[model samples]
Target: MKKLMMTATALALGAGMAAADTIRMGTEGAYPPYNFINDSGEVDGFERELGDELCKRAELTCEWVTNDWDSIIPNLVSGNYDTIIAGMTINDERDEVIDFTQNYTMPDPSAYLALSKDVDVDSGVVTAQTGTIQAAFVADSGATLVEFATPEETVAAVRNGEADAVLADKSYLVPIAEEDDSLVLLDREENINMGIGMGIRESDTELREKFDAAITSMKEDGSLNELIKKWDVGATFD
Candidate 1:
């Protein structure tokens, strides 16, 4: 949901979202099925489609902006973007920094990926994307947490034996595990389950309401569920 690129092209893209009627939709453009840069180098994925629809429903012009995951929230607070449509999980810690619209996605389980099912994920070295809840969980669980800048790097750490396992959203890992013969999902203990929502600045009450209403409409009309199933991200909002 977050990635940072300060190239001239990205800056121009950000400027486009700054138009009077355009709501900047910030994302990581690294998390697949959620957000990613496609072959055309444009933001493309589930959140891309969902954000566009939400903006349309809210009667707001919107444009996509990519920022690094580690600085996603900070950039939003700094007025670099109007809202974060990144696949951010709403939680108490995050709430202190930004206000989230009603959740667009239900809670998803985090998973552990390793080369073997029998790996001791609880105590051995684990890799997680920097600035994610998965990293926090590993830190507190007494495991040696190796942080990576991107999700792919986290997976690479495990594959290269730099870490014993990679912990991340199960939705993101399932396909990788299925495609790779050497990787397997370790038996999970009810991992952190949290609803994913769009992050808006704390002071943007009216804007938050606009998005919340749009999300509510999507839920009522069943389009949100269709998108969730289509993207295979996780269960729909309930």
Candidate 2:
């Protein structure tokens, strides 16, 4: 979930330019497994590790840039960064503004989470991160869609009764549900699944091709599967 995008050109104008050789990798350092800041106060998670490897394979110098999820794309277009290695789904709405490398991770399921299993996930109030496919689905489902800026806040909204349920990526909610007896994932699953990919400016076709090749190489060599299993993020890219 995130804030809506501004014009790509306008957003790009707001950000400072990056150097030629160094690709600035932007990410939302809050989502765990997929991405998050670790004890060392650095971007330390699945994407970080995967990103570093991709850069190595592509022979591209890279630097990490932590950003809020809401403005991640706009900032990329504005020139603040070169690529978004965050767990961003490849979807039609987003593809219109920025190009994505071939998917790096397989499609992940979206599920509803609630304090109890009996809540009507289809009809009751549902919360999701703003600007996400989950939020869009909830909006169109006729359920009351409450949106928060962060995934953590969406879960909190459900716990606090501000919303009856929270809809989000199953991998994200799985550990939380396992850790807390009060939280339960509903049986219903939303059909808005999409593979996650790296976001790049549309103008950077050559850069996209380089990362694409790196991703393909990892897939062929089985290193990509290793990372997926190591992080427990989701299934491998097909």
| TM-score on alpha carbons, each prediction | 0.90, 0.91
Off by over 4 Å in 1: 1-19
List the global CA lDDT of all models: 0.85, 0.85
Q: For residues 1-238, could you state the per-residue lDDT of candidate 1 as single tens digits? A: 1112222222222231333656789999999888999999999989999998887776676789999999999999999998998788888999999889988888889999999888898789999999888989899997899999999999999999999999999988998999999999988844585888999888777678777888888998889999999999998766
Off by over 4 Å in 2: 1-19
Q: List the residue pairs that clash in candidate 2.
A: 2-130, 11-78, 12-78
The CA lDDT at 188 in model 2 is 83
